[model samples]
Target: MEVDATALAGLQSEVSQLADLFKRRLFEDRSKNALIESVQDQVRAVNDLLRYREFEGLFKEALLAIDRLQSESSTPELVDSVVDELLEVFRRRDLVAVDDSGIFDPRVHEAIGTVPASADLRPNTIAAVHRTGYVLGDRLLRPAQVTVVVSVDD
Candidate 1:
């Protein structure tokens, strides 16, 4: 069968133009997606900063109150009440207390000192926790300040 040369050329031209249009549309879609991702990242960063600031203010207030109570030689019951209130605030914010397991984990615990290992305690284990650590939704807010056990030989 014989086809018209002019008609064939026209069809080819239309196909090429369609291909170019598709390419352009794909590029535009990708560009738009990238821009949206960048904007979302910025918003997430801002939200994190705001959350941190809020937690910082609360912690500062709690610390000041505890300090004042100590200076005033407040009753143990009063101090306990303040501590309970602070813990409640932490719980409400989804800040969980890090467990003080005998195992020492560098990722979640900060060793401030070392103590001689005892028969009851294994070496390299957490001997004491000076300050409690907290985590919020798998994000570590603070590492637990701790003392680790060391061998007497060392």
Candidate 2:
């Protein structure tokens, strides 16, 4: 038996074409994989942003409780009950209110302004709290905005 020269050439051409097609397919697969990874990253970022928004909502709820207490129409007992319920929600989530009655710590407190120290008050001590802050476990959600007592001369 003998092989035809034209048949052999035709077979070689088909194999070469298949190899090129395979290489192109591999390249396209790589590009698809990269795009899939990018999309996943963007999805994760969006989820994180949504979680942050929820955290802000919690703070707003606390502010609303304060507002209710200040409004004369709302009874003190009703405001107290609302505040207690809100605090329980925070307790369940492991969110604790920051304590501002101490030496000012830059790590946990933000000094929004400074007041002249009284004869007994020490400098760098927290004088007033402008805004309440909270912490989840060891993570700081927000720093307490406070007024610091400063020496009158300085």
Candidate 3:
């Protein structure tokens, strides 16, 4: 039996409406998924910032303790114990001390002052370390404060 023209047109209209509805729904789903991912990324960033703040506080405390120990005339045993405790805290936080080998590196060391270069010590070499620097997993957390040797003529 032949289908009625009016009936066929009505069926086509319904199919078109259904297809449009499906497309709209798919678009909405994708937008919702993108919004969810953005929120997740923001949350992760906030958590990372909080962790960094906590680590900063702990590091400052350890530095202060070490400074006090150095300023005061303490027994060798007490100084050793204090140093060990500071090191333990750093180790737990994955912080490594920057080596002070009289070698000056601008990347990890901050030259606070300059000293006269001697015959044995070359210019630009680290003469003294005023404050120790630290690194976290190949990333510098803080630059070491140091005094560098400068040529007497310069």
Candidate 4:
């Protein structure tokens, strides 16, 4: 079977037009996808800023309490009151103080130093705490700075 020259040329032209159409559609789809991704990123950035502003507003009172403690005239009672106020702010923001128990957990504790193990203190246990830590829900905001007890090497 032999295809006519005119018919063959017409088929080739039709195929070329189809190819060009496909290329144009592919480019348009890609452009549309890129624009959509850009919009989504912008929205996510806005949401993050809004969340930061909300947390900042919640800590305003805690900041004021801290400022009061900075004054030289602050007494022990005033210090205690300021501490309580700060804790209240943390609670309002769903933040909790990390528990620094005798047992040291690497997930929430940062070892600052080590002391020799004693009869009362077991190895790898917390001997002292230098700083307190906090957590926001399930996320760790800070690790407790603690001294761990190490076994005495002979």
Clashes of each: 0, 0, 0, 0
**Which candidate number maximizes TM-score?**
4
Model 4 poorest 10 in a row by lDDT: 66-75
- Model 1, residue 146: distance off in Å is 0.5
- Model 3, 10-71: lDDT tens digits are 99999999999999999999999999999999999999999999889787879887887878
lDDT order, best first, reads 4, 3, 2, 1
For each candidate, what is the lDDT?
A: 0.89, 0.89, 0.90, 0.91
Clashing pairs in 3: none
Model 3: ten consecutive residues of lowest lDDT: 84-93
The residue ranges of model 1 lying beyond 4 angstroms of the native Cα positions read 1-73
lDDT of 4: 0.91
- Which is the better candidate, 2 or 3, if ranked by lDDT? 3
Cα error of candidate 1 at position 70, Å: 13
Candidate 1, 1-154: lDDT as tens digits? 8999999999999999999999999999999999999999999999999999987977886787677677776888878877887887678778899987878888899999998888888998998999999998899999999999988874
Write model 2 residue lDDT over 47-111, tens digit each, in one string. 99999997887778777877767775787688778879788778777888888998999989999
The CA lDDT at 111 in model 1 is 94
